[model samples]
Target: MVAAALSAETTRAALFLAATVGNVLGALVNYALGRFAIRFEDRRWFPVSPLARQKAETLFARYGQPVLLFSWLPIVGDPLTLAAGLLRTPLTVFLAYVTIGKAGRYAALLWLMPS
Candidate 1:
């Protein structure tokens, strides 16, 4: 949907804006899910186990905010953001780091792609 909207002649700018918004919103959604939906006791639907959550918390605690820079990575990235939210990390700081990470990832992708 984003690629298609970006490709369209009339709505290129709008589509790009929408894509950015959508990406950020997705991160927020992940955060919310991790905070409220995923439970340590209920592992069936959540998938992430208590041990995994503890590991992630430990890693994030050790690494600090810099861990947000990896928010664009596959598999682990989304979960990391969610864990951050679940941990109740400061919202402004999380958003700033996440936006930078996400923007960098998109910019790199665009640069690597052929025109």
Candidate 2:
């Protein structure tokens, strides 16, 4: 979606700003979902095993802020952000990492695509 938008006749500044804003919004939504909507106790919805959550918690504890860098990975990325939010990870730190990760990911995608 972002790539398509950037490729349009829109001004470069506008495209860049849109992409950045979209990425941040996506991360924030993921964080909110994990923090409020999904419940660990609610097996029907979350369905993730206790062991998995424990592992994720341990990874987050060990990695601290850098874990946010992996927030782009398929399957794992969204959950990681959500877990970070649920764990009460500092908002500033989380946003910083998420922004960097998302920016880098989009930048790479933009770079790789044919002009």
Candidate 3:
């Protein structure tokens, strides 16, 4: 989607900005869901597993803020954002890491596409 937008005659920088903003918004939604999940964590039908949360926690412990750079990964990405909220990662800190990671991912994608 982003690449297609970029390929249009639209402003390249604006396209990039829009794409990054969209990605960040999606992550924030995941983070909010994570926060909400904490309240229902003990429910019988909760989707996210304890093991997944544990892995996210362990990775956060080991990598600290840097672990967020992997937030662009496909399967694991959403959970990482959720873990950030579940772990109460500071908002400013979360935004910084997430924005950079997401923007970088989009930038890389745009860069690799044929001009």
Winner by TM-score? 3
- lDDT per residue for candidate 1 within 27-114, as digits (tens), equals 8777777777765437576645667667667778889878988877876677777788788878888888888887776666554544
Q: Which residue pairs overlap in candidate 1's backbone?
A: none
Badly placed stretches (over 4 Å) of model 1 are 1-18, 38-43, 47-52
The segments of candidate 3 whose C-alpha lies over 4 angstroms from its true place after superposition are: 2-9, 41-47
Please estimate how well model 3 matches the true structure, expressed as its whole-model Cα lDDT.
Answer: 0.81
**Candidate lDDT values, in order:** 0.71, 0.72, 0.81
Q: For each candidate, what TM-score against the reference? A: 0.73, 0.73, 0.81
Q: Estimate, for each residue in 26-112, the C-alpha lDDT of model 3 and write its tens digit.
A: 988878767766788777765457787778878888888778888898867777888998888888899899999999988887777
Clashes of 3: 0
Q: So what's the TM-score on candidate 3? A: 0.81
Model 1 TM-score is 0.73
For model 2, where is the 10-residue window of minimal lDDT? 40-49
Answer with 1 or 3, whichever has the higher TM-score: 3
Off by over 4 Å in 2: 2-7, 11-13, 40-55
Which pairs of residues have clashing backbones in candidate 3? none
